[model samples]
Target: MKYLLFLSCLVISITNLYPASAHKVEVSGDVGGTLHIEPNDNPRAGEPSQAWFALTRRGGRVIPLSQCNCELAVYAQPYAAGEPPLLEPQLEPVSAERYKGIPGAEVVFPKPGIYELQLNGKPVSGARFKPFEFKFEVTVAGGSTQNSRNLRDVNGDLVEGESQKLPTWAIALPILGFIGILVVVLQNMRRSGE
Candidate 1:
């Protein structure tokens, strides 16, 4: 019974060691669908950042890229209080329902501040869907600051700051649980032999 309890604790702790995928922001479109946007990495000032967008109907059907003409517009919130700077972000279709920001032509925030992304487009050719528009807010951090970090993973891929560190408990508890389980199993086996 003690051995079984230790094994169950070890299994649960091990399962929680690895973190889940980062969360993406989702917005409902005015026309008739939901827009999902996932940034390749956290947006940094003066650094190019790529993001993926997907459009899906209320019924969960994906809208094909060929059937829609879409564009993304980026605007930086003014610091003192003037009008924001408007920029056109280049985007390319990745598949029927997915689009990615072009690497070189991707959006780069001019400074660390609040930014707004406006997505607009209409159904193309023979598509009967209405024009869609979406707006989302993004907050960038440590832009051009003295303490700014590259924020890339070991594979040179961009990652959010929150995901940079593994929780201490997540690692320590799993290891401790596994060690306890091993000890319990060895003791049980020795008693059974005797």
Candidate 2:
């Protein structure tokens, strides 16, 4: 039936509306797990982006910020030897699922390009997750990136990790939906005229 075909097309288009938001796994010495960046993977230039780390050990014990002396340093990609870090954002403990009191910070990319965020941590008191130095390569796009943490959303409410900018599916799905509707209408007209 035409209706059934239209419903199927609608379902397919709706399912592609979400973008990938998986936390990135980092390669470090003994203390490292996942790193999550707010507002999606590719942060844009001239906006504050929040980044956090979820560290675990062999037994999967969570490493809280209270137990580690961590430092974050950012460097431009293709960095030269002995070059100083471009910026060093202060580390703060952020509370969230699996990242309760974990090391996090806000960073603003000055321009669009490839950059590396490096995290080095050591035990503050007793040895927690062993010393680690994690590196993550982040690509910055040339535009203004806004997130709920730093800006108002569609509902004028602040919700972490949500961006106001329209997503790829938001643009594509509407076009596809319109086309599907048009097809259904055309099919109905043809049948009625018969």
Candidate 3:
């Protein structure tokens, strides 16, 4: 009984250590620098997501955010018909060297696919860097349009499509297992008392 309880606790602890859908990607700037973007969460269709960016020189020196005015432009690659509309993301300084995508200003990915993100800005404080422009190819995960059930299927892939619901058994099974363990522990205690 104690062993079962210990194992259950161990399993839950281990699972909590894994990240819950944050995605980070790095792109090389045209001026021999590195741009790192960490979307607060995995990009989903029609759902608001904020991304943080950090610009560092080739030798690992951070660039002051106040010295530059930055803008983000996202273009969905033409997947179906005519050219998709270009989306301009609102970026604001979160710190001296970091910028965050503003809530309403950030573009929600219309669908899951590759997007071309252009980060362009000019140095306002007489920084030696030229007008910087960095482009990155980002892939967004598909999300269901009808409901907000962020569940993975049996194959461990994100479940997409309308009319698809997360299986109740998936949630119930873990709870049932924990209850079963507790019942077994109580029974063992009762038997030992006798």
Candidate 4:
């Protein structure tokens, strides 16, 4: 009877540590490797992007995480007011125990802001399936501010490109903003003169 009680206690402790949602997400996979999104790695803009993660089990049980048919959702919220509105949340499907929603997959940040990725899955019976989630600070490539400039290296020189470089939109923003202000000022002057 004592042995039975001790065994039960040990099982409870192990179970407590292996909650269903123990996975951790990060920009780099070195962490828990729940989800890793490469900068400018977005494959499809209007469509869902592919995401890959190694699903693992916490116990000696013979169940697979893939049995749960995990679902992934991504959301983005702008950090600044007066910025563009938030984008519609995206739901992606998982293929195999490893997740790959869309081919050439990428996490699309409609605008620079804090974004969250959520993972929900069910494990085999007698196994815990906790919902996993992580938030990443995504500064989109283009914005009105130079500090937001996304620059890339070009043959030892910096050039504007989509990945790790200044994007064309980044260059255009200041110019466009200046032109917009000029037009507004001129219209106001004309109204005052009249």
Q: Which candidate is the best by lDDT?
A: 2
Identify the leading candidate in terms of TM-score.
2
Q: Model 3, which residues run further than 4 Å from truth?
A: 1-41, 79-85, 95-105, 144-194
Is candidate 2 or 4 superior in TM-score? 2
> Where does candidate 2 have its weakest 10-residue lDDT segment?
143-152
38-57 per-residue lDDT for model 4 (tens digits)? 42333233333445454443
Q: What's each prediction's TM-score? A: 0.50, 0.64, 0.50, 0.34
lDDT agreement with native, every candidate: 0.62, 0.80, 0.61, 0.44
lDDT of 3 by residue, 1-194 (tens): 56677867855854353356533445445343333333444577777665555665566555555666777778887444455437887776554234332112355788888887777767676765567777666677776565545667899888854575557876676677767766877787889889
Model 2 residue 157 CA deviation in Å: 31
Off by over 4 Å in 4: 1-33, 39-49, 59-65, 78-105, 124-140, 143-194
Number of backbone collisions per candidate: 0, 0, 0, 13
**Lowest summed lDDT over 10 consecutive residues: which window, candidate 1?**
96-105
Clashes of 1: 0
Q: How many times do residue backbones clash in model 2? A: 0
Per-residue lDDT value at 158 in model 3: 82
Order the candidates by lDDT, highest first: 2, 1, 3, 4
Off by over 4 Å in 1: 1-41, 78-85, 95-105, 144-194
